[model samples]
Target: MNDWRSHFGFHTTPFTRELAVAQRFPLPMFDEVLTALSRAVDQRGSAALVAPAGTGKTALLRALVDQLPEARYRVHYVKVTDLSKRDLCREIAVACGAQPAGSFPMLVRRLQEHFLSTLADDGVRPVLVLDDSHGLRPEVLGIFQILTNFEMDSRLVLSVLFVGQPPLRDLLRQPAHEAVTRRLVHLATLRLLSRPESHRYLAHRCTIAGATTIPFDPGAQEAVYEIACGNLRATDQLAAKALEVAHDAGAAIVDSAHLATSRRLLWP
Candidate 1:
């Protein structure tokens, strides 16, 4: 069967969630968040990144990891769920290259010492980036405060970053978690793209995929922004589906009709 790539003369599928760091869309809002998070990491401080679903939170975390140089930073990226505190610490210990086979208390001490030695002996930064942290329980979140406390909290040996959806903010706001919240040096929230930015984003994706000209009609572009509400992931899904629908129908450009059909076919 003929695919959209052949129909559109694309080098690869456009509007995919797969982000090639070299070719990522240069969004100014993302840059601003990156700057704040980067500064927090540099200072060996913790920060919170909160955004709604489909707003490119995972992509932003990957970009942040890529931008931090390996020579100076030892970064461990962990995607957390509702695991128990012991299980979570074991995962963290494994990520830090420490033995995860000890008792729960031993595991915690091992990770704390690992972070300390990583900075004091190796002279490199240890950054713990936790993604999807909204599911972490209140008590589990408190473990970070204890782990980050080294040398009587007089010195910082590690940097921690929490990336999750909006519920994470509410989670942190709870009275019990206020201690964890106070440790955050920055709180960055990602917003949806503006209408003009969304238009440019579509063009940018098309250009990166080797399209000499945009295949999405102006009306289709407007439909995408409207239906997807400028969420990056939603835009990708809708745009890719529209392309397939247009190609199947032998349409030269994806129009409002194609977008409407694609949305119905995808959602309903």
Candidate 2:
């Protein structure tokens, strides 16, 4: 049998590979978002999920995408940050496999028409997952309101799910954005993982990376949880570094020394 230890170097975790980590350390709070998304997609309604930075919002979205039944709906995930309204529309249009012919307004119209046609042909609702929506300009955010108009009497043809940080909630609260905000039937905010949850998260990542058992000592685990401040992103960063330190030292298990070294290296 191949030695699992040899998997080192090739086994590092990445921030973008959220589906793998989410499977190992499932966050229960995201279940509400998943349930809401599934129901909204079925009913063709709209929903929004918001949380603080480093609270695993991206990871939760990735997990939802991974869990979503491919046969039931067409999913288009887009991250809108620092992009102009025209650029955003073009990107969304391209994701849906349609090219816009003219200006920004024309592109929006084309995207809506394309989405409606797609839903009719595929017999499935079109789901648009917009991430970092808080970064969108007021005009661009208005595009979502326009899309929501493409709906039937009982079901919507296009369903939009907005995911972002707390500023997204603040943006929705603005009176100017009331139209889009009012259509959001479901709202959820992801919370930081509790202490035990953090511990489990670290151990889970280690195991997924091929470690048969947790390499961190009890004290080291506590230190990680404390310094990570309940954020999964921070925990993963610290834990991964600790593992690297242990691997380099040929230590079978990570101890207080490894934890201290990793902490100093990461935070200081």
Candidate 3:
């Protein structure tokens, strides 16, 4: 147990990365993005979720998986950072419970068959979440043509979601990657929070972590916002460390000075 968690009278650690889906911060923008992506998958369409690091893309995906009904949607999430076409095929095969051994062409064919069978036999749609896709080379992204195509482009049997950083938005716009870009029916991204939102978010994280009262005073909240610039993950890190600094000094509430010191410890 961290000394700060005990000092603050929290039942659990505040501002942590490990949060339950039910306990997720109730941000309206998160719900909006999830609904749009859910609607696209419902219609058997592809989509992209582009967000900068620490803006909560991964947490959003967790909520997305929960939103998709297990009985109706065969959702498989595979993180695709720097993976080759064959490596990606193997990862998807494993996610779908298929043997992950074959030539690249054979793997593709096998995956298509598995997706089709899942839909035809079980009345479930297959949704592939290709996460961290900004690392994919343009040529590697071309694999989407085969995955999304079936029966000479007459059947739509698979729905894919590309979740990645901002570069992914530009990568999809390149002419060489038009095939995959054209297949996307919805695009979404998370924005950095405004100053007011940052304060509310800090309080929410505190409450959810079982705090009776938020320890960060108004000035400390503003200090964190100034340094983290309203990024969710950044706020988490800054607030958590500031609490430690305050605890070390035997301070009951965190203040701007503690936040300033925490920033230097973190970044410098």
RMSD of 2: 3.1
- lDDT per residue as tens, model 2, 96-185: 888845798899889888888877887766889999888877667877888777554344678899888888888888898899888888
What is the TM-score of each predicted model, taking all chains together? 0.97, 0.88, 0.97
Q: Which candidate gets the maximum lDDT versus the true structure?
A: 3
Encode model 3's per-residue lDDT on 85-176: one tens digit a residue.
89889988998898899899999999999999999999999999988988887778889989899999999999999999999999999998
> How displaced is residue 83 in candidate 1, in Å?
0.3
Candidate order by TM-score, decreasing, is 3, 1, 2
TM-score between model 1 and native:
0.97
Please list the C-alpha lDDT of all candidates, in the order they appear: 0.90, 0.77, 0.92
lDDT measured at residue 220 in model 3 versus the true structure, 0 to 100: 97
State which candidate, 1 or 3, has the greater lDDT.
3
TM-score of 2: 0.88
Error of 3 at 187 (Å): 0.9
